[model samples]
Target: MKKITRKKHLEMRLQSIPSHPKPKVGLEQYTTPSVIASDLVWNAFSLGDIEDNVIVDLGCGTGVFAIASALMGANSSVGVDIDEDSIALALSVKDKLNVDNVDFVVSDICDFNQPLDADTVFQNPPFGSQRRAESGQDLKFVKKAISLDPKVLYSFHMASTEEFLIKFYSDNNLEITHIFRYNFPIPKIYDFHSKEKADVDVIVIRAELK
Candidate 1:
């Protein structure tokens, strides 16, 4: 298979991937837009982090980042999600697209003990916006990614939590190398969402182990 070396081609390929069957509101299961996913993956590749690298996507809802990385030439990719339905859909999309370099696993981010040996981790974890009890769930994903000790990590977080995340990463011995801001689109999937689509300020932080 010819690798998708261009961002536009990668985005086109990502558009064909399937999304979550039933998006869980509590899990903040919003599909990352293809454009955004493409930009992030391309950025990682440009930084020499994706091509021929072992990549992992934590909380990989429908496996957008993982598949995109594989399409861009990751040696191997693993997408781990707690939702079985999401993993199943991701696997189906992988088969449909014949994306042989990526694999999906159903597992909680907290309990995941797989030997990742990953060079990079690209994840869009829950922003922890739904319930008060789940407010800091994003941190759990960050902590787990840090524990894996990948060479680099690209993670999404609410822009409002920028300060907190900066501190959290620093404290965990991860150095923030780049931050990309985006207006993430959230479609009306829950009863409480009044608007058809709302833009939430989000930031993708690229960090390296310190």
Candidate 2:
């Protein structure tokens, strides 16, 4: 297989990973745009954290980061999600793309305590804004990643919570590294959505263990 050395090619490949067929409002199931996922994964690859590493994507909706890491030559990529429906979709795409290194597990992020030699973790967990999900759900993912003892973590959160997240991560022995900001588009998937699409300021923080 040819290596994906360019960002555009990797983004094009990630576009094949489909979104949730029936998004649940409670899960905050907005798909991370291929553009954003590609950029983040590419940066991780460039930083020497992805290629040939054991990659884990927590709360992976459709396995965007997992599949991207596989394409970028990760040793293995594991995508975990509580929703079986989403995992099913991820499996189908993995098979469709013949990506052998990428795998999916259907389990709640908090209940995921496998002894994975996780080298790096990429998570875009729920922002915890939905009443159905407990607030600070993203923090749970951070703790889980820390427990996995990965060398690095990349997580996304609302830009509004940047200060809180930085302090929380520092308190937990995670050293602040890079902050990548973007205007994430939220499509009108739920009835409560008032616009066709709205942009929310989001930040993807890259942190390493202290």
Candidate 3:
């Protein structure tokens, strides 16, 4: 497979990935936009994290991060999500694209016990802004990623929670490194949403577990 060297091309490729067909309100499942996903994956690739590495995407909705990582030269990309329907769609897309290196699993993040050592992990978990989001759900994802023992972790969070999350990561033994900010677009998928689409400030924290 040819490696996608440029971020622009990677973004273009990722833009074609389909979002969740039936987004669950309780899960707070929103598709990670292609622009942000590509930017983060490109940075990981540039940092010597992607090529020939086993990548994992936690809370993967429709496999954006996993598929993009595979395209960027990951040896294997595993996407884990609790939604079986989303996993089915992701598998269909993966088969359609002939991307043999990516795989999807249906499991709760806490219940996932796969023993494979992951080289890098990407997670765009819930921001805990909605009524259905349990408190510290994002922290749960952080802990699960650490359990995988990845060389590096790229996690998304509400930018407003930066200070608290920094302390949380430190408490969990993750050495702070780079922080990437983006305007995450949230489409009006639910009835509560008033706007057609809105951009929320989000941050992707890059860290290495000690």
Candidate 4:
């Protein structure tokens, strides 16, 4: 099968998400959802992931996953997010791609309309609460993915979250298919002027929907 890739185009879009109020500790920056999405997409495609599969991307910050799915020949790809700006940017990219296989919607993952037809889900939910300071937000996303009963689910999370996440999903009956670790660049405000940047280790978890 032929592979497709879309270039990142969210210069203005990134500006609209609103900068973090304070610097993130350890890593001064957080990874962009697009990078996370691309990493997931490449890995998924390498597994002979699926052709004409229904794919849903939750917390699709920039729609890279959604667009890549459509490009990869998924019968349908939908990206869902709570942020209006992010959704708008994603939609814009969707139009630019001119691929009818994908769509974007603005909604929270928990209450968003479920794609009963999807066989796979690709997501990069907030690694933690980061700006919001909430713990275990990844669990909420995992449960939601299982609720869809996809054959496979891919997610990017904090490396430190591995043990906690592994136990959490194991308790919930989800099995870890694979785990990939890499240095992830996190973007955040630094110093009094909020200009410094930092990179940290991030682990991407692949789990089978059992």
Candidate 5:
């Protein structure tokens, strides 16, 4: 398909996905904007490394990463999440984008099996602050990705969690190559005061498997 047609189709698919106030179990309900999606797309595309290599996005909220990877010429892309609603929305977006190179599945990261040899993996996991009791759940996703032998681009909370994530990556034999920092604006959750406070920053780290 022509690039323009593909672009328009993706735009429509993005519109189809439900925004905030809709809940997806095991996944936070942050409606990522086009700018953030583009940033992730560029990061993941840069890690393509080889032409037609496979890319996967763990906890792919709405399939933006997968969609962008397909557009950037990855041989194939897959997005895995436990949220059925998210899976449905992502599939709809794929149809609109006319991107047949990408697909999505509903599954938890811990229970996943590496069905394909992925050259790169991208992920935006939960900060594990809101409802998750564990403060370092994000690292599990990265660890699992590394175990699958894929270079990863992972988003994390830019607070003290940065140190924890760095150490975890190092321990797992993953090398951090680049860090993209941004102030992430989060929504006001139920009875959460800091939810509106801009105390939280975000960092996207690019890491390679050893």
Candidate 6:
């Protein structure tokens, strides 16, 4: 099979991948749109973070980022998620596509300690929009990513929290290298959704350990 070299090709591959069967609102389970995922993965690849590198995607919903990294020439990619259903779907897609460089594990971010020494950490974690109890979920992912001590990290967050995230990263000794803004499209998946589709402002932060 030919490698996925272009962003469009990568997006096409990801477009067919299935999403969670029953998305949980509290977990903020929304599939990352193919266009956004493609842009983020291609940008990381161009930054020398994906090709020939080991990557880990925390809170990986259906393994979009991890699988993309594998397709883009990562030496290996691991996706960890708390949802078993999501992991199962990700594994099925990996098998159907015959992608051998990526693996998916069902584990909560808090309990995940697999001795990972990844070169890059790519994650689209929960933006903490739904449940009030899960407000700081993104911060947990950030702290865990930092614990892995990767050379680079790409994390998605609500654009409104940019200032807070800047301070948070500074306190954690992580430097924000770049921030890419995107209008994330959220389809009405739950009963509480007021619109058929809502565009949310999000920022993908590229950070490095200081």
List the global CA lDDT of all models: 0.89, 0.91, 0.90, 0.68, 0.70, 0.91
Predicted candidate 2 versus true structure: per-residue lDDT over 151-209, tens digit per residue: 99999998999999989999999998999998899888888877898888899999999
Q: After TM-score superposition, what is the CA distance of residue 5 in candidate 3 from its true location, in Å?
A: 1.8
Clash counts per candidate, in order, are: 0, 0, 0, 4, 1, 0
- Misplaced by over 4 Å in model 4 are 1-36, 129-132, 189-195
Note each model's CA RMSD in angstroms: 1.2, 1.3, 1.1, 5.4, 3.5, 1.2
Off by over 4 Å in 6: 131-133
For model 3, the superposed segments whose C-alpha errors exceed 4 Å read none
Clashing pairs in 4: 29-186, 29-187, 30-186, 30-187
Better of 1 and 5 by TM-score: 1
| Candidate 6 residue 42 C-alpha distance from true site, Å | 0.1
Model 5 Cα lDDT, one tens digit per residue, 48-69:
5424778888888778777776
- Candidate 2 residue runs with Cα over 4 Å from true position: 129-133
- Candidate 3 lDDT over residue span 1-210, tens digit each: 676778999899888888887999889989888888898888888899899999999999899999998898889999999999989989988887789999999999899999878999999998875655687888899999999999999999989899999999999999989999999989999999888998888999999989
**How well is each residue in 80-194 modelled by candidate 1, as lDDT tens digits?**
9999999999999999999899999999988888996989998888886554436877788888898888999999999999998899999899999999999898888888878
Sequence-dependent TM-score of model 5? 0.82
Candidate 1 Cα outliers beyond 4 Å, as residue runs: 131-133
lDDT string, candidate 6, 1-210, tens digits: 578877898999989888688998778899999899999999999999999999999999899999999999999999999998899999999998889999999999888899867999988888865545368788889999988989999999999999999999999999999999999998889988888998889999999999
Candidate 4 per-residue C-alpha lDDT over 1-210 given as tens digits, one digit per residue, 9 for 90 to 100: 334543243222223332333323432223354444455566777775645788898877667677777777788898887776666767776776576888888888899866467788887766752554466666788888888888888887788878888888788787888998877665544443353555656777777866
Query: Ranking by lDDT, best first?
Result: 2, 6, 3, 1, 5, 4
